[model samples]
Target: MANLRDPVIGPVIRAEGLTKVYRSGPVEVQALRGVDFTAAAGEFVVILGPSGSGKSTFLNILGGLDTASAGRVWFRGLDLTALDDRGLTRYRRDHVGFVFQFYNLVPSLTALENVALVTEIARNPMPPAEALALVGLSARRDHFPAQLSGGEQQRVAIARAIAKRPELLFCDEPTGALDSATGIKVLEALTEVNRATGATTLVITHNAAIREIADRSLRFADGRIAEEVVNPVRKAPTEVSW
Candidate 1:
């Protein structure tokens, strides 16, 4: 494992020959197939694919939520594939943040409190209120998850993920559960957070329209990256359609 302070000369994240397999008795499934990938510092990347094309698997491996069966992954020059479970946990806690499709906020906690939960344990967290404000949720900070709209709840979840000031942010199907109008709102929040924090952000989604907001777009097929596009000019979330 490389030291945390070691300067990374190239990509903030790099992966080579990454692979993953899941087994169940006589059944075997390959989720990722020798994928090579990289992301520069503060890059906002969007990944698109049909279900089971390996997008989520790739994101999980890079974010330390899952390990690759073969090959290596590096973040800021630190070898992720070499870390044990405990080390991976620390890596996630200290350097990575994640938002999933579901707004997994505590039903009993207010939006502010839910965001505060992450800040309480973070090494260098921003104020919880400020995190909420980033997502345009400060006005509803006192509202419980049950009281907020779907988009608002998801924004709160984004606030929670970013509160820790992570070096990387991974969002998987973050707008999947919302309607078009609401999903656009959530996307706006995500784009704003990416711009404000400058975190190396990866958003995996089935919606291709979301790609317009990304600096780079990747398409996956049959457990491989099928195409890559560099959007010369990224459009604002409001300019995108579902």
Candidate 2:
């Protein structure tokens, strides 16, 4: 049976023949080389690659943080490569959420405050308390970043990311700073949000074991996607090892 989400939202993300060439003085480095990819709504995708394998480059372009040098990419038919900086900013603010390896929370702000800051500016946002509850951090919502553990801080980051109810999410090594158990908890929050919000989520990480939880996985090599793996049955984050 086809995933019900496939027909509902169609392909929320699409990339074709993407290339990124960065020039520094006389040096020209091709980060991504002719990559083509797509993700349906509510799909959980994982990307695995070593450092400098174009994983981050591709993700940055897909997330609207950077532009592609050639080809085109789209989020729900909005041509990202065609958007100017102002248009891209609007697109990001209205539709995209991001989580990085480091939780860049303000030291003086409590978790609730950190999340509330985003909700204040978002066009349509859930209450900060509800977002905290979604990440199992309702109790810690009042705690400052210094008071929270690494995993807890990351959960707060997740809460902040999803508080706006973004249609798309990009996580770049979200679990890179935590222990295995803590990482699993972070992944749990991510999966929960992806399920509840029907966001097309793309997680970029080096941990191969993490792929088990993805509906689709891409392995990038030397500035290109070398392999694609589709999971017949996705494993719950709790069941993933390493």
- Top candidate (TM-score): 1
Q: Could you give me the TM-score of model 2 versus the true structure?
A: 0.96
Model 1 bad stretches (over 4 Å): 1-8
> What number of clashing residue pairs does each candidate have, in the order they appear?
0, 0
TM-score for predicted model 1 compared with the true structure = 0.97
lDDT over C-alpha atoms for residue 37 of model 2: 92
Model 1 lDDT per residue over 1-242, tens place: 46563555689899999999999999989999899999988899999999999999999999999999999999876899999999999999999999999988999999999999999899989999999999998899999988999999999999999999988999999999999999999989988999999888999999998999999999999889999999999999899977
lDDT tens string, model 2, 140-195? 88899999999999999999999998888999999998999999999999999999
lDDT of each: 0.93, 0.92
| lDDT value, candidate 2, whole model | 0.92
Over 4 Å off in model 2, which ranges? 1-9
